[model samples]
Target: MTFNFLSPVSDEVLAHNELLTPQALGKKLKIHSKAHGLPDLDNVKIAIIGVLENRNDINYMGSEVELDSIRKVFYNLFPGNWYTNVADLGDILKGDAVGDTYFALRTTITILLEKKIIPVILGGSQDLTYPNYRAYDSICPMVNVVSVDSNFDLGDSTLPIKNNSYLGKIILEQPYNLFNYSTIGYQTYFNSQEEIDLMEKLYFEAYRLGEVSKSISLVEPVMRDAHIVSVDLKAIKASEVSKEQKYSPNGLDGKEICAIARYAGISNKVSSFGVYEYQHSKDDHITAMLVAQIIWYFIEGVNCRVSENVLSDSVNYQKYNVLIDDDELIFYKSKKTGRWWIEIPFLPDVNNKLKKHTLLPCMHEDYLEATQGKIPERWYKAYKKNSF
Candidate 1:
């Protein structure tokens, strides 16, 4: 009944799949249709939806649905060993008001997450991430978001919400469920100094585009700690997506974006993911396929998911205690995945939201940095945030 608000993928668009081979994804996954109604939700694992709203975007305007074109390429690629039943639930058509579309997305995604169905959203504008973030309000007491974008999107929350500044809405709005916000691939020139200072001031994390490109693995730890991952397509280079807003000669190339997507999907905590800021084009097959491949990598990462599905057994981990500036730091290394995590001790005096994870995910390098008598920035941030 939650899907009552959704419409099926247009048959006219689906007809394009006649060109697909039997092994193509078009023939493998179940799809929502006018005839078959919705896909079998009983066995469904991931639900894909296209949002048709973009009026709030200052950088881009109008509703240009690109999901069908993206699907033309997505359904043709052979899936990896992914056994999850992925359903294409069609598009959330644009409403009379942008806020109406936001309501639809928020309610629909909230239902999906409650059903344990992860939503893979194809967006009309990056502002859709606001509703995507809102969807988790009923499900999670505290949510952490990891955004892969060239800019922070932290516009003035006091003003009307726009794609360029919806994050400010998320940060300033009521119910204050956001525990951590980490932005990957933020280019310095695109963000104001005040935004950069605000990130540190709030204990939020922001990585420069160059730093992430140098070590793509740096995102895995960040992703491992996220519940929602929002991606702005412009973070990718213009060569990959010609219609990209603020298309730049320099950005995360195709391979890097795909790698980041994979990390997002592989995260134990990341439940819902979205790729936004897409526009329809006359010759967008290449861009469509590139988005499809980025999605493919995300699904591939979901397939490669380990440790998260299984309960963490203490026997499978090695624990170490290190003292840094009198405050003892505890670390755990997962023998199975070689992933590291640092523990945050409970200070009863301080209100903490990390009751579920006193031991947050970390990189081995964080442990090494701590061993050198220097507190890792991540640990310090987490400590500072939790202490308050």
Candidate 2:
């Protein structure tokens, strides 16, 4: 039942190798000189959530080792005194029952969100996404999630409540507006036609590997709009780094993965981000280095964004909401003049459905009703109008 934060690496061993200690990792990655006009961390909060449990599928386990590698890399990369507040939340206690593990993760994530800290989760399996999403729900009722993966992750009717299709469960239980959901780098072989149909019905945006490489520009806006990002290691091609299930012969390269992480890091709206399904057992030294590189890129992006005051603009304003329906959720863009605008409708079949609606003056009751008391009315209206 006890959770251990530090890895098994002994200080003696690290000292002998002149490795950077965990305490020094964040400082080493600090951006003293602001480049790219990113925000500073004077008011920003950052936390790391590392999970070790790897079950449900063979490919999903043993990511804690990868996390350890990431920690070491960060320590070595950022050597100076920097970073506002960075701490490892520790690993979820293993040997607890399945429900216990889920609760543990959920509790940890909730704690971070309550403190308004951005959480970067190094996951044991893709199943971690479910709990991560649930934890965010406690703070923000509506979240725009962008998942980078190789599969639809929507398994058959059997209902994969495990590491694989927990996202499907999330989509089902949460009041999620699928219009805000996008699955990038999906491989056709790993996904079924029914899954695609379901995603279409749910209005989830998907881009195949071919399309992603051809249209990398499409990635920025998706990252810009998301509130959370769940990245699966399997999204990368096996030829690049092989570890997780659903590894594709054709996939994104290390540079592409780094770019995605960088984009996710700078997106002010993203409150929580996770990289999952990395199996150290199957990973080569190069693969481990690649994983470490990805984390480094994420840290670099986060530091830049914090230093640049990226979130300040939206701090006073409320983020938008997605109207959830059984079949689809709608996305609305708000006008500066205060109007409810439907920027993207949930159903794709609807033609030129984009329209603006005059929103009523902000009212406490309506605000409470719109976000179910999770957000303010003006913010909700503005979010619906696409202002934030």
Candidate 3:
């Protein structure tokens, strides 16, 4: 069926589906683009699927109504033809069981992947990542995931499939080696000792709020190796949220959230991205605005990478050397003079092996540090004669 955000669904379809009529669905929202002009769906490399289902037993606020509101808010915030190519694959059919909902989402992602479209899923719960990742598994040999959340999401499966425990289920089912997963902005309150222990055992990299600001650089490298990104809204502090089921007095501010989104967009390896658990019912205009901005940043990042030829061979092979020291690891770019020079003041913390080694697509100094330098050390030297 023809999809138009500005127009309503056809009467026959609405009647058959018992869905909201165009008028009742609310006004058409528009968002302006800063760079790519209007979106061209035919040329769309990114496809966003909004999953409104909240079937889980979690304490999440809002429901299908909030999902509709979020759609409108996004329309208004990103008015124009910015994502002309980015089609809204539309909402998944509502389901009674969490498994049922996840099934529909999984099917949608599978179809999108077949079409070679980058899926941007507006989440129902963190569990959504399971299917999103599953879709990638069918096509990609390996899938890397980056989770921005306050909890480890590695809770025991005894708990019902709800918002908080889905990620854990995904980890249990998916191969750990296939995932270059990292959890960011986690809080001590949301995780249990057992859960934390489980994460450590799994070798899952985590960064607390205090470390997030310092570790912002870690995002790119984590994303560099990733095939998909799963962002949980709860990772942002409650202070930054307009409305939330477990709204905290504090969370990642808007700026930090957007920067992370941008980082995801710029990572050429990220074939799909999803954001979950944004409760629109309790959200004020400000929260809606922030959510819209986050989505916009994702769009911007995609456009930036696409245009910068990030995926192109010329840009893809550009190398950065990562060096590790006792205190911190540094990144250096090889100069034509055959000397290593510090392009940025910061160095990505990388594995000891990456020192004096070469990295692809140039490493983000911050991500190298955050991942603790998974890159080989031979590509990076701790002591260069020109060390800054």
Clashes of each: 0, 18, 49
Better of 2 and 3 by TM-score: 3
Please give, for residues 124-237, the per-residue lDDT of candidate 1 as tens digits: 888899899999888998899999999999989999999889899999998899999999998899999999999999999999998998999999999999999999888887
- RMSD, each candidate, Å? 1.7, 10.8, 9.0
Output the number of the lDDT-best candidate.
1
For model 3, the stretches where C-alpha displacement exceeds 4 angstroms are 1-41, 60-65, 78-84, 174-177, 243-246, 306-388
Candidate 1 backbone clash number: 0
By lDDT, rank the candidates, best first. Answer: 1, 2, 3
Question: Can you write out model 2's per-residue Cα lDDT over 1-388, one digit (the tens) per residue?
Answer: 2222223333332443355455455342322111212223344477666677666554543344445555555555543233555544434545455566677777777776776778788867787787777776657755678889988777642555776677677777746533357788888888888888887665567888887888675576567667778998888987887444336678888888888888787666677888887666544556666776776676666665632221233333344554444312222332322222222322233432224332222322333355553433233333443422
**Candidate 2 residue runs with Cα over 4 Å from true position:** 1-18, 21-44, 58-66, 79-85, 157-160, 174-179, 242-246, 306-388
With candidate 3 superimposed using the best TM-score fit, by how many Å does residue 320's alpha carbon deviate from the native? 7.4
TM-score (all chains, Cα) for each model? 0.96, 0.69, 0.70
